[model samples]
Target: MVRKIAAAAIAALFVPVVQAAGWEKLWTFEHGAGTSVAGQTSEILAFDSLNNELWVAGLKGVDILNAATGSFVQHIDTTAFGELNSVAIRNGVAAFAIAAPIKTDAGSVLTYDTTSRSFQQSYLVGALPDMVTFTADGRIMTANEGEPLARPGFATIEARGSISIIDTTKDSVTTLGFSGYDGTTGLGRIVSPGAKPSIDWEPEYIALSKDGQFAMVTLQEANAVAKIDLMSQQIVSVTSLGLKDHSLPGNELDTTDRDLPGNVSVAGNYRNAPVFGMYMPDTIASYASGGKTYYITANEGDSRNLEDFVNGEFNEEVRVGSSSYVLDPTAFPDAAALKATSNLGRLTVTTSGGDLDGDGDYDQIHVFGGRSFSILDENGNQVFDSGNQLEALLFADPALRALIDDGRSDNKGVEPEGVTVLELGDRTLAFIGFERTRQSVIAIYDVTNPTAATFVDFIVDADSLSPEGLSAYEFGGKYFLAVANEVSGTTSLFSITPVPEPETYAMLLAGLGLIGLAARRRRG
Candidate 1:
């Protein structure tokens, strides 16, 4: 259903007047329907404008859809390869990354001829190729996360993360490893405790520049972004996104969901707290603004702790009573206040950076992932951060706020997991998907002015929960958005149409008035 907000409500929320750019939901397809089966988590999506088809990568296999009607056309069984992780289409060939049947650390890319709808070839790639994208120069790229499995009797082999660059023309694959670079040398690195830049850094997502000259890869676990020179086929630099101060005004976040005993509250009373936040981005996209190329990131944090350091070890709750967690008593005058309000329960003096008095205890604490998206320059310098803009807007509007509660506040608030940018009629729009919310929402932003992006509208659907992949395309003279919802095992389609400007409405009214006046004169 299309959600509408009154002008008064918009003004109260300090948002721009609701535009008429109608985002109408066309249809939704359930998981395991048509070629897809139940329990197959649809993770990634790619649109084939040439054939008017949509390609989806799920647990079972790849499902193809008619882009116009959202109907299933075919399902490509990937039983030979393993589970399907990601999909991409270019030059009329659909490509998918399939994990190996027995090996968890190895995968292959299966390419199919869209016209013939038959398998063409399969190329071997690294373990857990999570994301796939095509460059302007016919090069298919995949970000191999190389995350080790966390199960008993699992292989103890350390999986080194790398980027697989496939030359579609030559049908050759080149693996570029990030192990060579250490903070001591060429590029500055963001070093977290127990995280070896070479071993622990996992490449999550890849975003190519418009010209395809450079590729920005998000090292999600490292809280850093790596710049890759496509021509040189090497990582040029890895810049760390420093911690965000949660004590600031726009950076305030609700620290807890268990406010009063047993009941879980949906509404988060956000407050400015003393802590540092890591910007561990999950999904990233690049766009050009002010004649320069920039990248946008959805800071959805993730970490793996199977072997070494346990997860949540640095949390304030775990370290508060420990003698090792020394605090600068002067910095935190009221130690009890810090303990009560801290989101992580306890503050760690060992891992986090700040040491005011140089005496053992930490003056500040750090946490994972900025709960919003950010715009960064080519060198990985942050240009503009959404900060609490997303959270504030969601909290202010009753309709949208009700969709997500404070349950996720202590974690990744509204978890902006997926992002994509599309240019529509001189406007550059950014679509962001929230993963943790009850009712999934694709928040639309007018990102043409990257510095001053305005929240335009939201595409809400109860069935579209946990949107894992999103792509926007213009086909048959209309713009369409496709979302892969993992939780409900479905795919949803929506059409976006620009709302007419106020001047257009005024001109129409004036022309009608003049026509009425002319008719009366003629009758008299």
Candidate 2:
């Protein structure tokens, strides 16, 4: 349902939403449906700009999607190899993990040929593979989910989670241990304190900065994200978070403080805290725009109780809802302690806007929950709140009320998993991809306007697109959005073209020539 906000209010309020003609479905590949490797489909994995193809890895095989034709060009049958969990492509080579039947001991790192479209030998010895990435110097690295072994009471906790570096050129692997982690070597339930075994948290996913110099992986169990210096082959820092931060003054730390009834301390294996539920981050993304790098993470939801913890009776307070933590990970050790400091309210400062408080260069960010979305400026301050605005605008008109109610509807609302920016007309449109639905849908909003947004139609069939990972890149003057469908086991492609009126092009060309002439004069 398209709801219209007056162009006048959008201009006056400096809102970000601008109108687009409409979103049309481009194409869909049906070959991925029910495609399994080891009884599981190659869930959508990643898009490779270097190769101009989509990489889909699953329990059964890996399929390459041809971007131009929207068809599977090749498939690497892995039924003989094992179940695959993650896949990454770099320098025209794709490396992935093969998870076996059991959880803990199932991972093996394998490589694929982009030119030949064939599987290379598996790098077994140091292939502690969970998430795979390439170093700046072109070496393959796997953030080992550790040896996936069952935890004490809760069966599956296999990933003893660690990181291993593989020199693809030399075909050698080196283990880079995590700090404060020690447990059994293989599939066994054990924890020897001070194992200093390094990396205990189950690192679910890995993200690299544009330059590929910095790599960050999400550690679900440890409640942290580790930053690795690829070239140095060392971990620069680990940002640790937990429920202990949520507790109030008088709260107690007994079983009563947790969600799972009975002694949670004994559940010990998973470190399931009462208020934080499971404080593992499910996803991570990186963007470098306007001279700064930003890392964004999505936390499913917090179940721990902050009220009880803050009473100070409990050990920790659970800060539920979603959180946005931004900083230059490059400034470590000095800013290491700052990892604990979230701009809880308005901690960041914005240079472009009047939001400069002289603190960290914080740009405002927007967050959405089940019902609403919010934008907070750098001062750790909130600029506009949907819940608050809804209340105030409730008395506007019955039509407006209906529009708000419809927009806020449960089924229609999107759980945004990935966001990308595109230049549409004279403005930049933020294209947000949704989870919870297999259909590839893009929700467009003018980043310049927070209050106004346009929800576009879904890309492929609701039954066909189980998009999980999204990476946007431009090639040959055409824009493409690559989607990894984790469920259907394929990567779907979409082309984003900016439609500009004749007058718009004329204005842009005129502006460019003036800049070019000025540059020539300066050189003379």
Candidate 3:
């Protein structure tokens, strides 16, 4: 406990904006900054295009702000409804997903007229609707997580994860569950010892298809994704996102939080290891490229320990070098030296699966996350993975070196949590938010080609921390990205300016040549 506290304290102590694009911080809004509810005012936000207002969801309620200036215009106290989870706006209407105080029970989607700030309609849905999104045609969808409340010596209430669809035109709701795969080996990754796949799979976020005919829900803990055919309201496929092989060259990672003598500067210890990481993505977004739909995910990992719950004591996580975990001598001939603290000893990994020969010893090591963002095909196959670049960039950048919590190196580096994409001219820019970093560190990538993507920049800001949600917009001839920081309870806006096109550069060179010729003529 003492070591854990000390580690937390140390972790707390810790942009290519000039190239492909330049960015500027426009304004920020603090939610309940001075009141008792300070630093607890936000989780998600949505922009009402028609009303030109941004609706922010927090514990207390919703805060309405001027999207143009980041000024608070009004507040709506929604405590009576329940715990607010997410907000989405479309046309002139806003939908708020509110989970019941007891999240295991049913939740509801409340719609409001953004123009009048008044309630319009309500539709009951599934439990713990963590994310709400709208199609361009006004179809509403929610990813109902249905998380379990666990305690020792007590019965756990396990609610099945589900997706809820609400048809605005029909004023009806349809909730879909994973009952068909409950008893089967359908959920690809880790599953709770005695829990069915239906209850074990928790939906974290939702991303819709371009044509509004399908939706993909992120089953984060399961390390899988479910494709829903919106036209049929059926879960067409559930694909396991597979694992990241750290043995590969570019997939290497910094494995420990070893600080120097004075703890004044954090040093990076990066290398390849005999391990694999489950791509348990928390957030995902879809885009169309070359007639193909590709999904981008921030590979944030998660683990659940049964010892911490009322379920059977089978912890999913254990230190790689722990006595309880054994490496098969046949697989790892040099296991002793590999167990060093600077090596894999201090690295935390999942223990649920790995015994290839059933000899009660692991032949492979599996960690929680990939520590990178991945671009996947419509079938959930990885087309491209960032691989070591996130950590490489962190150690490479002098400005971000101090912010690289060495404490997080042993676990998920930077902990890429939120993901959103924007269209800048001909380039598709992906912004990945790191939650575990000291402040706001957003990694931008140009993912024009699914097979080959390039890193654009790494943008950071002290005003934002632990960004839980991101929304990118283009209004008034400028592109802006809004970040909702959970820890700071602040919503920040940054305007993006892209680099000139090749044609523009050609024109400039031509004009410069003309000026040079005129100067020569004048000299003659």
Candidate 4:
């Protein structure tokens, strides 16, 4: 049966955002599906230019919908291909990345005809092909995560991470593997204990340059980015994304939420600490500025299997004040006091890092994720970091603060997990999604000035939860932002118009021939 938004809901569209930027909610489409991963029904979204529709990829299959109306069209079930991870559409073709029955085995990429909603062809790729995209010149690029897994009795099985490039004209595939960088060192690239760079590195996401000459691949576990020369089809460079110094004045973070005096679970005890944060970004987007390319990262942190703690295996996360945790007395003068719950003691740090010396004790404390968004140069140098901005913003707003999940306070706060860059008229803005928040809070920033990026406002929706994917596009003479809320299982559409300057607003008014002021539409 065709599921479409009711006429009443469609008529009540274009409601203006009350608190922040004047973005209006169009309609939210609920995808009633379940997956093995946290019951999430949506993970990624793709736009079909030829059909003018939205194809939302979930673990079960793909759900097609009318982009402008958020009305359901049809769902193409590809369950035989295994769990679908990502999808991309271009030139009327939709490509999906699917893992094999055994995730460790090789995966496949299947292409479908959007017009007919029929299967076109399939190509074999590397293990756990998680992300798929199409280049401007009609080529498919995939980031095969090749995650590491442990079997019964601690038997480790690993699949080497790689990038697969599909050339349709040539009917061939060229894989860019990390074998050469197996023992690679330096540049803040981390090799997990008892693992090589090839097996330890997992490619999480991919972004392309404006000119389509290069590609940026995010290695989340390695805390680095790999540059691929598309023209050469080779791995050009791997740059390490250095850690963020929380000891800096602007980089303050709240470590233990339930430990401080006068602290509610939603409260923050923001202070400087002897800790460094790894900018292990999840989703990345690239844009051009000043004839150079820059990448935007949503630094939502992750550890190696939180379930390992229950499985009696080596867990990567350890509390600073845990019984097994040992700090170098000399490196930290006030070791006993630092272990207190009000201090860094209750905070979780990665056990795989921070042992600067060969000694048993840790000389430094390293934590997962920057807990904020960041901008990096083409060479993977940090140009801007939203230091303590997200933590400060949520705490300052009572309405937003009331929706916080206290369970996440001991870890990453307002985890910025998804990001997309868009050119809305004269401004190049970045929309970042917080995956940890109960409410879908997409913070906007004016990144027109890359070096000195500033916050504009936030787009918050109470009906949404755990926004995992964000995509922006212009349709029917209007700009829109679509968010895929994983937890709520709803994909929401919002109409966004850039606030105009004084002269620009006057010019727009004169051009439209409006004699009296027109109030913007306000509805939910």
Candidate 5:
């Protein structure tokens, strides 16, 4: 027991020191310090290589910063316009934001030309745009967070949510609208004013597949993620991550007596239901690995109880670390239909199977939570709902659980808003980022092995990293992680050099010795 205790102590010592050392402070950008139209930075940021710079968008106009020095480059004036909520840079031209005038029913999408250094074109968007992403083929996909339709005496009032897709080459933009909850089939669920009493349903963010054929969007106030098919323009998959049962008649706001799996049926007549069932999903990412496309979104929703329930201030604040969905692009009916209901599951990585490894293994998903970073399957089911065929759950240890739980606490690790899986040499590494709030961290995981994966400790910490939007790119034979910081109002470029593990180093030395001996033999 003494020996085991000593070993545990040694292991614990390695945790804080190593994790803290991994993150290196790259750069800091004070948005308003020296630049025009500067104030608090919004959580939305993006990279535009066409102009060879990083674009930071906030409540003010858009700021273009030098990617290398994190220096204040230039700011696009949107004062003639309105507050900027989203930005997209493509083909060397930048399109920042679209918004309505104060208390006015007017909004437009503004484009900034990198070559001319001028505002190029302005197109109309229906509602207030929150987030925007570039498609695989250079299309601009934007999402808004206002109610799309309104009706009195409706159980679930439709939140005016709009997604705008812009074809840059043709300068043509299409706007698609969706209401918060569609109860036509008696299948939709939502919160009542009496139950929630505080929250409102709205869309928050958007992301797209590599080919731009599919889009995964987050309805923040709605507390749901909808999968939209850009081709057919229909919502295909809708997943709710909040409580489902409702108390008041025609109300779907309710909670389970005990925490139940999100996909399972909730208890009937749940009380104290909130306005939206699911929490707010703040970020979204799309990646294609192992021949499957996955749409990952960040859930940063805060939970608050009704005023009458406690008569005091109490925040239940349930946040899903990070969740993802996978769907076949060909199976989607249209671009808009991608948000329709379908088979969707949480993104959990485990050796117990469920397609977590992309290997046809049945027992891959291990039951675990408190993960701010995750990768979803291209096939949808996080873990194949197989009977307990595997002997034991993979990575089913308390240490990992404790780490996740601690990391998920509001005061501990902030919301992991960005994630990307990149190919490092012959292996694959998952780059995860937690942002907003002051404490930001980036974690690197060696995910090469389908059954066994290694956490390379914390590769980046709060000191050097405050990642808002992260993308792993390869330039000049080196791996670079482009981090967009919301609070700092700057984006830094990080170089990820290959760090060989102890076993790999030992193997390399052994192979070299063997080669030297063979050469000596040949010489003799």
Candidate 6:
């Protein structure tokens, strides 16, 4: 049975007046001077357990902070390395991915010795290494998002994305290319005709298996997940996360925020459209349950229309005629409703997935990410998806609903972006970050039972806006959660204590009763 925490209880505990929940806000620290160039700020976070410090990937360089108290310790300037994208720490060594300074499709990783507090080495990696993680066997893995920089007159100069594996013992780098996984014959290819599995697949984030034997990377644009065998250093499979049927009862999504004139609603115009919703996950995490390995993904969708959107090649208003699969009158009772009520704005389907039915019109319409998170089995089959559940929880409370305007419903509602899982005593908790929500929030859920995740609490701080990174650690017998707020240039810290189980409560009650009986006997 799934246990539900009452919304009233959560709201009451969240208020400044009370501290009823097990989560406590520790401190929030803004970066020095709290100013940086746009698009450059606190991008990622990692904790160095050996040094008892937290490393943050910031605009100018990496910032080191005291893990116990959110105080600044030191700043490691990395300007010479180029813009820093992510940071990872393991075995007293820290590594960060830096974009290339030149026009080449290549990036580099800088390693630092935490104990010595000095730069150790630098290694060239693939283009735009977006995220980095260390395996249990001391191998550094980086997800290189091989996104090409637009050059004039060059239609396709982009290099294919890849995963770079570094052996710390030998200081050697091995890159696994995605061009081979082009969805031709392997599980990487989607059945959807529109899926251009070859060139468009960009590896966004990666999650290592619990035992560290395998790594699963998310292809955000391709709506797929790739499993890599850490030992053999080969991509075993790439499985497409098929679409979610929004017309289904539990999968309804608010397709439009435009309600009738007089009503300024938070729920927006809810729709049960008969269309497939893409599960374009941004950040993914893995856990083991029931002797099975499961992965959780924060389905934050993305699209590529840099050239086409500017060239007027496609517009939301430019209807693909009545033959377009999106114009199913059965889904939208009124024929004109598609144009009038759709919150999809101006977006076009990619030309990759072939046109099914051969009617000279696109047979399917693909939208952005699922706007939620999902738990998938080791095979990439979804065990449970929080379809519109996050939106429903936020909207149910007027105060939380008002935190972010309803306009976001049109484009990636709430936008679940980052996720981190930690073991709290007997329970395993998953913390999900909302990136686009005006006031970002960390939604905590008890994922002990992956299929039946139950909402427990939400951590909201003034500085939590556009949370791009999350790191959790245990120090001095206490667990701590760190949030890297990109927009605010701040790192928010919180302490978490797991809720006691029913058995614990019962034992406490029985002990109290026994004490009372002993006191009565002594009196007699």
Report the number of the highest-TM-score candidate.
4
What tens-digit string does per-residue lDDT give for candidate 5 at 1-524?
00000001111111110111122345656666555453746345666665556777766677777766777777776766876777777677676656776412435677777766786777776566766667767777777665332223333233345677777678787877544334232121233322220124445677676666787776654445667788876666666543312122222211221233443432221122211222245675555556666655444443223332334332232222222333223332341232222111221222211233453432221212222333334322221110110000101122222222221222212445566666766666666565533344555655454223334433333443356667676655766666666656555566666544322100112221110000000000
TM-score of each: 0.85, 0.57, 0.88, 0.89, 0.61, 0.84
Q: Which residue window of length 10 is worst by lDDT in model 4?
A: 2-11
Q: Summarize candidate 6's per-residue lDDT along 195-235 as a digit string, tens digits.
A: 34554577899998887889999988778898999999998
Whole-model lDDT, model 5: 0.46
Off by over 4 Å in 6: 1-21, 32-40, 102-104, 153-156, 183-198, 262-266, 308-334, 342-355, 358-360, 502-524
Error of 5 at 482 (Å): 3.0
- Ranking the candidates on TM-score from highest down gives 4, 3, 1, 6, 5, 2
RMSD of 6: 8.4
> Model 3 Cα displacement at 439 (Å)?
1.5
Model 5 spans > 4 angstroms off? 1-26, 35-42, 103-106, 147-159, 168-171, 179-181, 184-189, 192-201, 241-280, 303-371, 379-413, 436-438, 446-454, 459-466, 488-490, 500-524
Better of 1 and 4 by TM-score: 4
Going through the candidates in order, what is the number of backbone clashes in each? 11, 65, 0, 0, 50, 5
Give the runs in model 4 whose Cα sits over 4 Å from its true position. 1-21, 33-40, 261-266, 306-310, 502-523
- Candidate 1, residue 276: the lDDT equals 77
Candidate 1 lDDT over residue span 1-524, tens digit each: 33333211111123342243557788887768444665566778999878998888888888888877878888877876786788989879888887676444677888889888888887888777888888888788888887655445543455667889888678899888776774443232233444456665788899998777999999887788888899988888888898888877667677666554454453656677777778889999988877788888998876444545344332222244345555577777776655542334432222434554556677876566788889998889998887776776666555567776676666667888999888777777788998888887777776776676666666788776898799988888898789998887888888887655511111112321111000000000
